[model samples]
Target: MNRKKLEALQGWSFISPALIVISIFVIGSIIFTIYISFHRVNLFTGYYEFIGLDNYKRLFNDTKVLIAFKNTLSFVAVVVPIQTFLAMVMASVLNAKIKGVKVFRIAYFLPTLTSSAALTMIFMFLFSLYGPINQIALQLNIINEPINFLNDAKVALKVIMSMNIWSTVPFFMVIYLAALQEVPEAIYEAARVDGATNVQQFFKITIPQLKPITTFVLLMGIIGTFQMFDQAYIFSNGSGGPENSTLTVALLSYRYAFGQNSTMGFAAAIALVLALLILVVSLIAQKLNKSDTLY
Candidate 1:
């Protein structure tokens, strides 16, 4: 046995446990999901009959699936950038050495650290028919009647979108705050001395310096929003609301997999499609970030 070969063997042995864990949880689950997608299975029986492309075909033809896809895409498209921009703005303002800065930072970040379940519950109360929101609107004479924030299909999705933004903003704000602190103060000072306005300094100096962190936050936001299930599930009581306006791919897959009408194969197929969608979005986000790099 050569000395170098023995050293290599020892290194592999040290990492073998972690590698095995990853393979079992990550790789094994992926392979199982793919395998099930190509089969016909259900909860009553463990029987998995080989049925290649059948699940995929049905998935594409399913109207509910299509709506879920559309809703998921629309939510991500509208939410991610808006949340990121808001976070950046908040982070920039907080970065300034203003009075009571620490208190302000804590106040802004409280929501990020709070439990999602609690936040969703509070939102439900706020959006209830005769809740504070409607009361205020009535007092202001904005409407002749109370609005059903989660019942109107036309506005249900938008309401969810707004809630999602509110829930996610504080998290991204923390990320942006950390990134902003890492940015060189000298660069912003120089830009200001060159007659650059605050907005210009932010655009030209802060943004460029924070590209790497911004890219990270963007990627995380996409993945998180893509798999958004908790808030909608809680707020809508897992029904996805009146007209399925708040239906999401993750929630749909969960419904199919373990809910009342469990179709294991179809559920697996949904999971596979969602995985592909996330992979494509992540790749595109990375590509766009890389292409637009200043450094």
Candidate 2:
């Protein structure tokens, strides 16, 4: 065999084990989930009954499912834009190489270093009725009483939204930071020569150049926020309570799969639908952004 063929074989050999493992675990599980979605399944009793599209049909009649849909869509809609804009602006600032920039970077990135579950717990404590947030609000007379952010239907999702934004912004900021570093200095100099101010250059040159990164930030933000379950689950204690305010589609799938009744088929169907929703939304966003256009 030629030396080129031998080198290619070696490369494949090195990667083949990981590829096989992924095919078995990730791909296998996905196929199994899709199969289960078409049938009634009970894990404990090994009960399996063919039900075809009945589970998907139940989605229409399930009020909680509809609520979860609304909540998840609202979360993606609100959080994606805010976080994307924030990340870009913050990246622009950090790219300026100011004094004490390292300290600021570390402080901003601390939340991203923490695990999601840990962050969720900490946020819950901070936002709790008797927690420091309310204590300070009370001290400042921000309200007549302590707001039950956790228990109020009107504010529950908003609390999660705030936590999500705070935790995720730094991570996306890092991505934008990297992209900002790649912006050619010549481009900025050209803009300046054309009598463009910093703000004008940012809006006209930097933003346009960072379109690909913006798309990535938006896509990841949408997917992450759309699949938000851990925070909502921890906040609502898996009951999706306060009038089902924090009930997310993922948490709802958990309830269906293992809650009062184990409707595995329904849970799988819900999951499939969610996957499709994420795919469709991401595609639409990419189409709108046209991030693949060469600069």
Clashes of each: 0, 0
User: What is candidate 2's TM-score against the reference?
Assistant: 0.94
Q: How high is the lDDT of residue 262 in model 2?
A: 97
Q: State in Å the error of residue 171, model 2.
A: 0.4
State the lDDT of candidate 2 residue by residue for 231-270, as single tens digits: 8888888999699989999999999999878999999999
For 1-295, candidate 1 gives per-residue lDDT tens digits of 9999999999999999999999999999999989888988875867779999999999879988999999998998999999989998999999999999999988988887878899888887888899999999999999889999978888888877888898789889888887776677888788888899999988888888778778878889889988999987997788887789889999988888888767789989998888888898789778877765433
Q: In candidate 1, which residue ranges exceed 4 Å CA deviation?
A: 1-11, 290-295
Clashes of 2: 0
Question: How high a TM-score does candidate 1 get?
Answer: 0.92
Number of the predicted model whose lDDT against the real structure is largest:
2
Using TM-score as the measure, the top candidate is: 2
RMSD to true structure for each model, in Å: 2.0, 1.8
